[model samples]
Target: MSRVKESIEVDVPVRTAYDQWTQFESFPQFMDGVERIEQRTDKLTHWVTKISGVKREFDAEITEQIPDAKVAWVTVAGEGEQSGLVTFQPIDPTHTQVTLMMDFDPEGMAENIGDKLGFVDRQVKGDLKRFKHFIEDRGTATGQWRGQV
Candidate 1:
């Protein structure tokens, strides 16, 4: 398994950051390889992504969720095996620290090579940076989900 962890500080409140993150459909805006995310249900999501010219689809189930705190998920059915968690920590009313941790098994030669070379780590970092910009630029959440799971 390959694990990647990345974090970024955003100039937004924890609620704002967590709210924006709950809008999974907006991930394509900041996530590099994501093509689309469909919220099938409150705890289920379908994702389409393309990385390094390779495309894949997957269904992920939210394992645990705590509003303004954390969200955890695992791939239920997909072309790959993976799990991830994202957490939001309040630094101040106008500042938030967001952290993402992912564990995945490379499925193909290309993916394996990328994992071994730290490509996945760099990608996670870049994604977090983009997310920081996406949220900080807006200065507010596009939407919010407060339901617990």
Candidate 2:
């Protein structure tokens, strides 16, 4: 397994940032390589992603979720073994620090090589940067899910 951690500061409130993240289907707007995300249930989602010419589909279950604080998930059944957590910290009323940590296992030669070469790390960083822009530009969440788990 390989791990990647990245963080960014967004010009938005913690609640705003966290709420936007709960809109799983909107991830493709800022997350590179993500083709689509379908919220199957409050705690489950289906993901379709393409990276480096490889396309994968997976089902992820939200293992833990705390509104305005963190969200964690793991692949329940999929083409890959992966899990991740994202946290939101309020710096002030108008600033939020968002962090993402992910763990994944490379399946084959291509994936193994890419993982070793820091491909995943770079991708995560880029995705977070895009997310910063996305939320800051909107200045409001598309939706909110405040249920606890």
Best by lDDT: 2
Among all windows of ten consecutive residues in candidate 1, which has the lowest summed lDDT? 106-115
- Give, for candidate 2, the lowest lDDT window spanning 10 residues: 140-149
* Candidate 2 segments whose C-alpha is farther than 4 A from its true place: none
Which regions of candidate 1 are displaced past 4 Å? none
lDDT of 1 by residue, 21-117 (tens): 9999999999999999999999999999999999999999999999999999999998899999999999999999999999999987888998999
The per-model lDDT (C-alpha) reads 0.95, 0.96
TM per model? 0.98, 0.98
Task: Report how far residue 101 has shifted in candidate 2, in Å.
Answer: 0.4
RMSD of each: 0.7, 0.6
